[model samples]
Target chain A: MADDSTSNTPRDHGDKTIEFSGLVCPVPLQDYPNIILGHGGGGKLSADLVQHVFLPAFQNDHLAVLGDSAVFQLAGVQLAGQRLAMSTDSYVVRPLFFPGGSIGDLVVNGTVNDLAMSGATPLYLTAAFILEEGFPIAQLKRIADAMGAAARRAGVAIISGDTKVVERGHGDGCYINTAGVGIVPDGIDIAPNHTRPGDVVILSGTLGDHGMAIMSVREGLEFDAEIRSDSAPLADMVAGIIQVCPDVHTLRDPTRGGLSASLNEIAAASGCGIVIDETRLPIHPTVQSACEILGFDPLLVANEGKLVCMVPAESADAVLNAIRSDKHGSGAAIIGRVVADHPGVVVAKTAIGASRVVVAPIGEQLPRIC
Target chain B: MADDSTSNTPRDHGDKTIEFSGLVCPVPLQDYPNIILGHGGGGKLSADLVQHVFLPAFQNDHLAVLGDSAVFQLAGVQLAGQRLAMSTDSYVVRPLFFPGGSIGDLVVNGTVNDLAMSGATPLYLTAAFILEEGFPIAQLKRIADAMGAAARRAGVAIISGDTKVVERGHGDGCYINTAGVGIVPDGIDIAPNHTRPGDVVILSGTLGDHGMAIMSVREGLEFDAEIRSDSAPLADMVAGIIQVCPDVHTLRDPTRGGLSASLNEIAAASGCGIVIDETRLPIHPTVQSACEILGFDPLLVANEGKLVCMVPAESADAVLNAIRSDKHGSGAAIIGRVVADHPGVVVAKTAIGASRVVVAPIGEQLPRIC
Candidate 1:
């Protein structure tokens, strides 16, 4: 694990060789040799990277919580007890425009959703753009306009922005990073670690639509029905859930490594087992068909507008009803439950009445899905 | 200005022509025919791009103020009267590592300083990284360590982070975007539009060290003395100044297009004229020599750790004292004063007793100086 490959001399590890001059390696290289796309895929690899690299360097009481967003209080007389949530995500989806949504919409909705997952009322966002030198100004304007529309729909103001242009060919046309700040109302505390053994898992909507939408565009494969990205804001739906059940244990948006990743994270964070019935998952027909064609599993595919919630069994019905009342969460359904046995694991009951462990993907099945 | 170049057919504008397919342009393209390096140089071109593109798209009450950070209040009863500041910046400097500082330090300090500029006590930060595939993980750890150290020095916590990797050749090693949130104490308000006719301009320290440091390393030019980047955090100094002079009108860091750009922005935003004595501008001798050799104007060169402050004449002495007491501002000096004549213009009093208009650079004198 202690791979000292950045020395003046060349060093070989397994099948990979790395060499550099006049630079010292500060942290030990563990597991993977070099950073692969999967390291950013929010799966086992992404988690490993965070555990070994980022967490150690930036460990703090707030970050250690590792919720969708960092929740903290302002330390001033006027702002005492004001809990704020902040989160950031960078969007680098290929084929900037896709069915039902564009990268612009994804960037805004993605960060908003992350903050929403923390049970916060997202208020303002900051956007930064990294554009290729020759990127069309017209396309930029379109993206910006789309972002504006999305922010308006989400009821969040884009209060600050920065733009940088890399030399042509150094970027994929454009990439955007948005950071959002939201307020967590009193009595609403949601985090992965808050999950309890008696919590019921509810999914807000269909899965795989967002991932399949991007995949279809990239692969040029078509089905009888068009699949659109489920890229919509979930803050209102989340607010409704909190209003109905303020003791909601956890909330997660299935993005990047998708449902499996989110479920595994919650299980690990809470030291509880999650059991889901595969047949109960709400997947769109077109998305299911596309996933079949692409050899993808809907369970591991991304969804931008969907969320998974963990609430006490007694409050499950109320939370589900609140979620169903929202347009974005009309398809909400109960899919699973948390258990004390088999802690830090997730199990799926198959249609054939057999049960199997549902493992998080090591990397991304669909790169840049969000 | 309405350049509809995203149509399937080609379109020509003056000497430059642009053509795209299947996309519609939503905003008018003005000034520059295409996105250039200058658009991200933080000079006039950069300002034009924001004025024409970003501002129109993301215009809001908070954003329209155009302070270093957006200052706003939470809408809830618990957080009422609590004003918060948020700012974001992206660092894409070449040769990731340079004398006295690296991109890691810049990423942390840059955002911290921006929040400090708004008279906010820097509190939390979120960082997102876009890394190129095949980049050494060991180097990444080193950068992460540097970021951690810088955050510690700035007295801020990096509470959240996201990482994404582009395929090799699609990125220049790494680019980091950091967004910071800070709490503004009651009765403290700082913004460019608050500048008044009787405000005295004070500079914290010497200029051009950061840009020159990067330039010296990039150009492989060795001078008699090593030019180190003054990439230090200014939050503590700012807090001290605010404590002494709560009514400080404006604060700006001389980053990307440097002092010229910052002064020009204050002049334009406040509708006030600024007159600076060139002889009083504090500049390191080595930096001056480097600028002469590189044909770069010190006024147009970037400084990572310096700040320009605008305060009423009565508070100038106290503010200067507050600044000078801090190590980062030991060389604090009054270089200029705001004037009612020639609003929206900045002038320099040359050593020969003659004055000349100091126009903001049309583009970056030194690209990626930050």
Candidate 2:
């Protein structure tokens, strides 16, 4: 985790940017070998490794492309306003089988949510995997069965995919990295920067259920109330919301860093402040109790089946109603309002009437141990 | 480093069934709350992990997909007697700065070579990075600069990318994963299955430069003659060969598992025998010295810039002539020939006329310590 100093320069984020100070490492990339691990480490060396070794091989117009997401004219709609959104995310939840969902469900739902967040119609997905040396035959059949069911529930096609097996120990039990390509609805341009101070923040359900559930299972701990993961696909809920209101400003799923990290990201990107009411947040009794005992903040926990939306002040109610219509969003609640005072910051009104600033999480409680 | 099981499986090679009876532990994707490092250990747990988790997530499309690499379709091509080919790889090589190439160069060239091996026109690429906390700003700039340059040389755009930062320690310095899509030319269907007796096996340039470069730098062992990584892009060379003879049989880069493993795979996949003249195999003098001192087999070493190409008996001379025209392929040589005996096995002809069977490497000597 030592690539921080190289990232926080005066060129891009401003020399005074205080972002990534904790999560970013401060190690100078150590170049060893004709190559070394850092090249794959996702640090400077990794970037350089790709640039120097790969780019020149097959230089072409398409290969020269670069963007957060590729923009193209899929339908009659052009790029700016009426473009379809497509994306993918491979869920490598450590436990193939979770307290609630299995890797099968996670793969479909994870990518569906990604497309939904981009305001896309989740149409199709591609699931690929790297199997290790000595995998069991029966276990594979069960997982395949789970995937088929999950895809059917999501109403999307498993379309196509790939698989490969590394020698044992070369790979984890199984690593699923999915690539989903969907079409963003026409006349919709939802991005991180679309959030406005006047927007109302809505959460589809209780926070931290998925993260806490996984954590509990991993840590071998339990609460009085069984805390099961809320790892369901959200594309349907997103479609339902769009059907009710098309003027949503922004959408995002608070996954890795949970709601707090997601809100802060939206705030920073939109240069707006977000104020949340702690009382408005819907936390399951089991999740709350687990957080209390674990000494971990629910805001920083991970989530598998949750979405955060910042809608126009005018359509917040309709959006909420539409989301609540879906079983996945039965716990829908209006949690906050985007504000102007603390640009790039998320401030929460505590249950005790006090205010606290929740910044992005420093590190993951659960490591690739994903 | 995990996810090495590529979906390289195609419908054609149904004969090569990988029997892992001796493998330690396969992908026994059980219902787990948290998976251990053993899943990636490349042994029994590794196989079980993949079988249980990944295989189900991506039910085995084919044995190739279940084996080491995946052979997938490339988009936008419907030529007679041909199929497009696409492959992708993640470069998490540690030590951002390497002897010769950086992560930037690796990504571009790695993807390019993959398409090249399929006799495809390596066209588009997408690079995604997960950076850890505290990466250096200056180093990132260097990598970006290097990436731009590499893309320029390769004559390709980086196309698109996504960046996510993990908390320090949770991630190494950084992890760069790339997905590439290419167009396979018509009249060209080159895969391991295409090999047959009387086919000529060609080795382009030198071997082990990339792997040795990584090892020496990582271990801090300096050779009298400094060794640099052979991490150049090979798309141009591929293009050269394709242009001259579209009938060229196969193109494959020997990377992670090295030439030995790659050759063995091709042998098994084709259900044919390969006899390589080990004495004629190319190895940089300095690299050979490093491998000797480290007690590493040169054949097991990685090659980022080079490729193993098996051409049709009729086109062998033309292919070699074509390859020698390019700088990267100037050192290409006829290393061996395909035979009928020892089906699904590679045989290297020793200098003294001794023959030793080379099976597809069972495991990685250089662990994901990629």
- Highest TM-score: give the candidate number: 1
lDDT measured at residue B104 in model 1 versus the true structure, 0 to 100: 89
Tens-digit per-residue lDDT, A262-299, candidate 2: 88768767888899999999999889888888887888
User: Cα lDDT for residue A251, model 2?
Assistant: 84
Give the Cα error of residue A224 in candidate 1, in Å.
0.9
Candidate 2 local lDDT, B1-370, one digit each (tens):
1332232222233344444323222322333323333343333334455555544554434322332234443222222333434455555565777878788778677766766676666544555555555665446556666766776676555554545444454445555555554455555666677777888998888888888888898899977887887777777888888777776766678876678867776775677778899999988899889989999888877788888888878888888888888888888899999888877667788889898766444445665423
| lDDT minimum window of 10 residues, candidate 1 chain A | A17-26
Chain A: TM-score in each model: 0.92, 0.81
**Per-prediction TM-score, please?**
0.93, 0.70
CA lDDT of each prediction against the hidden true structure:
0.87, 0.65
Cα lDDT over the full model 2: 0.65
- CA displacement after TM-score superposition, residue B35 of candidate 1 (Å): 1.3
